[model samples]
Target chain A: MTVTSSVPGAVPPPSTEVGPRIEPRIALSIRDLTKRYGSVAAIDRLSLDIASGEFLSLLGPSGSGKSTILMAIAGFVDPDGGDILLDGQPVGGLPPEKRGFGVVFQGYALFPHMTVRGNIAYPLKLRGIRGAELDRRVERAIDLVHLQAFAARMPRQLSGGQQQRVALARALVFDPAVVLLDEPLSALDKKLRAELQFELKSLHQRLGTTFVNVTHDQEEAMTMSDRIVILRDGRVQQTGTPDALYNTPATRFVADFLGRANFLDGVAGSVSGGCLTIDIDGASVRHRLRDGEPRMGRTALLALRPERLSVLAPDAAVGDRNRVEGRVVTSAFVGSQHIHVVETPLGVLEAHTPAFGAGVLRKPGEAVALAWPWDGGVLVEDR
Target chain B: MAKRPLSGEPYVGFLLPATLLVCGLFLIPIGQLVALSFGGLEAPTLRWYEQVAATDSIHRILLTTFRIVGLTTVIAVVLGYAVAYAMAHMGERQRLALLLCVLVPFWLSVLVRALAWLILLRNNGIVNEALLGSGLIAAPLPLVRNELGVVIGMVHYLVPYAVFPIFATMRGLDGRLMMAARSVGASPFRTFTDVYLPLTLPALFGAGLLVFVFGLGFFVTPAILGGGRVVMLSEYVSISVLQTLRWGLAAALSVVLLVATLALIAIVSRVTGVRRMLGAS
Candidate 1:
């Protein structure tokens, strides 16, 4: 279910009526942000609006300016151009401390000298909250991260996951309006990272705070984010809901980045009724236009997910359209599914079959027929 | 029995060479001094110890030595922290220029630097000449041949030593931690105090102790700048040994000075790990 939440602390309830009209309920707006090191531009003109209380991830490979965007939001890296607005106020010139953001760095960056309790209590002390109230807030933050038992221990004495929790608790102690995570789970093992990913998502739901995370791991982004912004070469490739980007990727980059896909190069044919036929080499594969259809005679690239393609069983009739035959070159059993590599006339393709289900295993060099529904493919403009 | 070179011999072999060097160079001299302090010139008596401990001149010299050392250390550490902070955040060209500024004075001959200060601080020196030209002063000011002059020269020489260690530590510090602090709603000053300062305390204390100990044995700067007016322990000992040929008294005073400086270093060592403080740049 889609959920909308009132920000826990947008304004102090006194100045909400005097402001200008705002859209997207944007918790953080990075507008035309750019940073350069000498001659190399680290971040080119990038603009994105993050809805309040939503988990938005800036997903990119290394040097794609994902972490730079996160740091700019945290007010650590000053952009050469563009302005960052938090709740509709320009925050470009503001120092990091005045930004009031909570950041979980890649390595956690827990104060090594401080115990878990001391680390969490730091922001409270900075806010001038002390004594019993400070202790209660610290305790609440510690318990929120499920690190109460380890509060008295030094950060070095804790495990990687526990240290990450302490880092989270320390960041959240003062109840910051927004939290920025810079690959906070990249240091953990696979199992621990998976566990913390769930914990972080649940914590975001419980706290109702805007979270901007940066990661190169597409799985982490797809699993935890409300919206994922795919970045490449210091620019935004696409931004949308995970399903939207997955199913209707705006470009070939997004389609390939979000998940694995097979692309079919073709020349666009006529659009009769709602269906459009594309001339793929010598084979004519008909597809239904969902959103943006390619013009006639334009070279278009069709993106089809591997799982959507199915192998037809013997004595079974082929579908009305979008059917092809290929030879299964190799197949391997992978726990719950059998992964098959089919050598098609177009190219080699992959398909996953249920390992436990009633499906005849296709041995190597077996001639097979592959068919996909017309609605299961996306037509991306060749750029 | 022929030993199989001790199973843990490699580790010991690594530590042994350095340990032997330290013992031969440092421990032996201090041990000899301690032995001599308890011995006597005429006979094995406690008379020189009693005289050295009871005399007002030696006591005054000791007080002067500590005062100079303490003041130099405090000022150098504070100024060094500022220089180190500047170095840490400065752009490449600026950082190089500032580092050159800190090191050039340190590398210059101590006597030349002291003489240069004396020339600037004397009655008809450039400082008074400028002040007179600007009409800021009616007469030449008293600067050299006093405690102020000695303090100035000593602090100048010690500041570079202090800055290097603090700067080295600050450079290795993760800047992201400070960014994290600021993100948690701290002001720049508050973040510095709450996060950066505490992280760099070990280096600061270490630099202070190192500068202070070095300041105690200062011989050339005090002799040239003091002009016989401010008699630090080193100058006093020089006078006793060379001018008066009072060997017994000079040895006793030298022993006292050595012990006091070593004691101060030991006290500082207790505050933080000494090996680390000295080992770092």
Candidate 2:
């Protein structure tokens, strides 16, 4: 499947268009990190290297150890058997204060007793900054987040979005080596969260500080990150750019977690010229083996994204596409797209089609042919 | 109810019992004391007030009372803040155990606790014996029957009061603020001074006010531990009434104490807002 804009015309151009590729320098390296709580490993021997000035996100579901990894990097949670290195220096023994990384907590964690200016001025003041220089830096930080007008207000006096901006300003004011965000936008409403997601991406581009965000929202991770790390059960499932992960997921969990996927269980019949022939419910299915080595006579699973499958009229030309006859069981109009659940010989398959003007939508119980290219299916390891 | 109002305002009847109780038990006695302080209701005069103002001993006693109360409040609040901070950061079982340790003195009577301290601090008591036995001093120290004994007893009594408000404030504090501060490059010491200490100020002030007000009216501990030497306001009032038969002077002193305490509470509430001063906010 290709990386098509999920919300067409609603999102701006992708962030990659603004800059050419630059050589990446390693900023922070987490080596062989392990943490356990009474025999249950929260982070089990995880290692990752974050490049300088790159926006990376640790994305996973609850209990997937994403937050634990973020905490370990932020020096809040001590790892049992690993070292965190900042700029090639081992900082595992350093306290969080000595680590000198900015962190934006989930709840915005702004000081309630302090005004916005005071909150933003805190880290600078701790560094013994005072007078005009401090004021200028604090003002610039507040201006960075567009919170100039609300600088005099207390945290409780501001709205949630405003509080989030204050938190952002406070975190960025110190100009640390990296900024760690723990689901910073998760507490916001949907509309505000989307707005901040766009703003955070733009801010990262403007500042060019290494940002490591932890979130369970797949769309959020995809929209704001330069690379996404998918984790499950204290282990790294896949780490790649959002497009790469979406188009070519390495495992069933990565495919299922990143977006919707339809799994077809089949037995491989033969392999010829890099193409694997499989039998699915007495029907011959062909899948192009891209980076996988599937063995013959073994059961295999193919992950087909719903958007890659198209529903056609019963008598439509198949034309070298993988076709299956199915009866439409349910169809839903989701404004921008139509989702149809079709009962087929292989099992139930979900298909998504863009909702254009006055298109023919198949009704329930109608016989329909679902067609997709052979390359649309990716061989994914079963979890 | 004679046809309750339809506006949904709080019913005055619900407050009637508490109001009657306060007026009967608190206001009337204070009113009587004020009236009696002015040379009784028959010929109300400011003779006792003038006499109290003229007496050097009354002035000295008032100064002594202020000193003891101020010292006790500072000592109790500082000690209580440490205990409360420790309790706030302890694990659940440890916090509960520390809380019990703080509160056990309350289970015993104030006079009993004062007597216990007397046994420990008297010249011939265990503390002096230990010190003398250890060659830490040439003679048995004068640890009791003075200002030191009274302060020790009062601070012990006031600490639990100080702990409750400060602990409440500490518990209400969001600990993540400290983490955020540390992440932003503030050292642990700086974080405490910059974030934690300022956030817990309201609790400290509230606890200080509580301890100070309670110490102002203390009688039992001072009477037991002072050994008739440190003449605080309460003991002086009792001496005037019981031994000297100066009922007017005693009444005057009581009126002054009541007025001073109320004025202090009013000023504190005005400064910090009563809800915050009580650590309720």
Candidate 3:
């Protein structure tokens, strides 16, 4: 029963990727956390270390235990086992209020009865700060969210984005040790979400407060997080920078979740010159192995991104790229890219090209060749 | 109905039935009551109103009515708030059970509930007998036969009125607000005062006003529980009509009670409705 929750791709690559250049002080650490509801476990034995002032995102689909992990860190959920530490001190005995970690709920839960000014002053007043100091702090907090003029308005009177800003201001007013956001931007329109993504990122930069965010939106996680920990069934599939996860996903799930992917099944061949040559449907393919040793003689799975493949005339110069001949089965123009579906001997493959410089759209049944670089694909664990 | 009306202006005939019913059933009767309070439709007089303003017993009765109704409103609202909070947070089964606890008694006849309280609260009743058996009192306490019994009966009858409105508002509130408050350095008690209590205040006041108006018109409970000693405004108005045959005085008291209730409704709706209970749902 526990085998389903185990991570087969737990072995990460050599951890020498140059991330943030700071001292990398550890701010929060989760150790062997486990939470179960009756017979089923929402979160398994998960461990994570967050750096000081780092914007870390727990990325996973619904019921993958991403929200449970965030709730545990915020002290809204009590784990059945293991411990949570804040700044290297165990905080298992603390409640949510005493934990000193601010949380922005998913729906922006603003106090409807209070004005914007009153909502922002709530935390300060609870801390026993009053009079001139309280007023000055509340003013600063409201100004930080750019909502000073609307301070007298009730929460329902404001727009959704304005209400979100007030919620954020209320959380950060007391200078919490850490801030947890549970899908903060999920309630906004797409354009507003994109705007606030950068706005929130810059806010984190200016404050230098450690932020732990939980989101199922891969684009949102990639846009705002300094590091991403992709979870599958309550276990970490991979934890790396956004660029690393996008380029070299450790599992088939991560690759498929992050972006469009083409999984090619092939048998592993001999390794030579830092390349692993494999045979796919009687055609040879080559992939540059980074640091991990190749799985020799066993069936291998290669994750090929669609944009890395290019369509060519059947008689064009192949150069050093791996080429396969096929017929154009479908063609489309999707805003910025011209997508072509080519049926080859191996399978139906796709190629995306820049829409502006892309010549003419390939018609159906046109003979074409698809070529990809040797290093464009990565070896991902099928598990 | 179509999306738009057939004409730009309202039909005007659509309001005929309800308007006619109101004018026939309500306005005409109220006009007659007002006309009777002055001597008659033909010859108007202020004698009954003058008598009311000058009499000491009328003043005492008005004061007594306000005091009893005010006390009943406060107790019922507080108890209702507590019950509503529990209903809002408890499990589904428990919440349904508690709702039945409020609703079943609400559906019971007001006379039946008043008598039930009499049976439990009277001297040598279950409460006094139990206390006597436990040696907690030397003699049977005067639990009924006065203002205390009247208040007890009225509060019991009015609690369901207070619970429904408050509970409906509580159900609409987002539970995340409580969590958000705690996440922002507010303890449980502080979160209640700072967030929960303030958010539900409009509903509280609304329920209080509803209870007060209903308590103002109460007659059966006070008549039975007051043991003929604690006569409220409603009971006095009854006496004026049935016992003394003073229809003019009865008509004047009825006008005063109705006007007072309407004035209170207007004032409360003004104060609590200023914000329109903005975002109350």
Candidate 4:
């Protein structure tokens, strides 16, 4: 892979260390898109602006309008209202072929009758490119996906991962303005899915083309996308960087969907020293105001990640961190980490601890104190 | 292995009745026919086959049969493909409606269907009377009792056969391939020609072969619609047997027709494997 990087016009190495580079120009903009079948709206009035050369993922479960948004952008589904703009030009009037955006379907959708070279050369041939120039582009695409050896093989003969690579190559061969992928890797096994996820992310970095991916897998979205748009019930629940969405989710659905979150329901008592104290049953818990300021005497929910809570010994010195006493309900060893479910006064809180030798293992029915920093718990609004 | 009693018999015992019925009903009759074509009991001579080859009328009859069958096959396939494509893309209820429409003719007897066409297509028939009344033509056109009538009747009868295989293949086709093609910048027309047409080629060939082979030996529709003006191979064979009592010539002609059909199937199966041609996938 490194050897080809020096070749002219070849893809450069994927920048693994740096974060997503935010470009100045917007490549595509979707405004007030709406699509309905019968009485159910598949895509409600949703709007989003995609930056150039950014890897954006629409992350959600099935029927969450993620795939609908991708299809609307690719011009496969006609929106009832609103417009889609490509480089500041309205493209809703154009057909899918004229829109000039490539898409990789869920099943790869490779031509079963055509060879790999023929499949990759299809779009170029449609544009009247022929002979030497066509061959050059096809060869370059084959090399881009590292499938030169399988250029003569049919789609059915290739493995699932290889077929996905061919699909990726074919989508890129036409030099489309943006590529839309609709769950392209969901067909593979877990190990191959992880491998292709890394390759897809690196491929985006090297090519620097705008990519729009729709997937239900939160981990995949977090690992590959520069920005994630969390959708639910045909509406945009939240949109932000992976870190922001994971760390400070704006809603209960966003917090629960992104990771394992333990919710603590309480009534806001009073505000003191930039912190809001909430009364859970009779115990008072303090949390920093991150998402929004809580109103006095109003109910609120706090999202605490399992990994954020640590089990502390009874004799441990308590500092500024919020502490709670609970009885261990059950604990399980999961190779690198141990998950303990504890019954607390507020609710059953789950804590994840590293299986390192530094901590003593807690047994079932044993009482333990759980502690977390004041800023660790995020305030989220109930849906 | 459970070591059942029938397992060691290689399953031939289960096939006994069917095998005996087929041999008695089909194979023995064919063997006797072939033997009769060689001048039965006369030391096996080629005089009957020679007589058939030497007859000028036989050449003309073969030509007419080929022309009619070829035209009917092509017409049925083209029309059937359009109907099948429509059905494949329709909603479930609409698709079922179309399927019933296609199957309605199959419920009618072939002779009844041919007689119905004869009533509608003959001179002074409903179609001609309507055309003459509308002043579309100055006189009643020749709509039946000719090659054109034979082709029309034959095509109608063969269309259902042509539709089944192509429709099966179209139903099995992944619609996403067409979407992928469009997404890759190919126009809708190009996507149909490049992706869809190629994928369905095997089934089309199978349907064409089926219609052609069936039309080759067709008897009822051509005899009724042709009104004795067009003498196809099957009708000639019947006349030779029933009218003239020329058993040897009839058997010779029948053998030739059978050989031609089988050879064509063999060649097509070699080109596209039979399973694939039948739209297995």
lDDT of each: 0.81, 0.87, 0.87, 0.88
Per-residue C-alpha lDDT of model 3 across residues A255-286, encoded as one tens digit per residue: 99987888888988888998888889788899
lDDT: worst 10-residue window of model 4 chain B: B1-10
Candidate 3 lDDT score at position A257? 90
Each candidate's chain B TM-score? 0.89, 0.95, 0.92, 0.95
Tens digit of lDDT per residue, candidate 4, span B1-281? 33464556766577878999999999999999999998896699898899888999999999999999999999999999999999999999999999999999988999999999999998889999999999999988898999999999999999999999999999999988999999998898999999999999899999999999999989999899999999999999999999999999999999999899999999998898898897775
- List ranges where model 2 is wrong by over 4 Å: A1-22, A271-275, A291-297, A313-318, A325-330, A358-369, B1-20, B35-44, B240-248
User: Model 4, stretches more than 4 Å misplaced?
Assistant: A1-23, A291-297, A312-319, A359-367, B1-25, B35-43
Error of 4 at B186 (Å): 1.4
Better of 1 and 3 by TM-score: 3
C-alpha DockQ for predicted model 2: 0.77
lDDT winner among the candidates?
A: 4
Error of 4 at A138 (Å): 0.9
TM-score of chain B of 1: 0.89
List the DockQ of the predictions in order: 0.60, 0.77, 0.77, 0.84
Model 1, runs deviating above 4 Å: A1-24, A34-43, A80-83, A269-288, A291-297, A309-334, A337-343, A358-374, B1-20, B40-45, B240-251, B273-281
User: A1-383 in candidate 2: lDDT tens per residue?
Assistant: 11111111233322211112324577888877889998998887777778899898999999989998988888899889988989999988999998888899989899887999999998899899999999999999999999989999999999999999999889999898899999999999999999999999999999999999999999999999998878887877777788888987767888899999999989887878677887998987788777544442488888999999989998999886799999999998888889999999989999989889654578999999999987888877776
Each prediction's RMSD over C-alphas, in Å, is 6.4, 5.9, 3.8, 6.8
The first chain of model 4 has a TM-score of 0.92
- Of the native A-B interface contacts, what share survives in model 4? 0.91
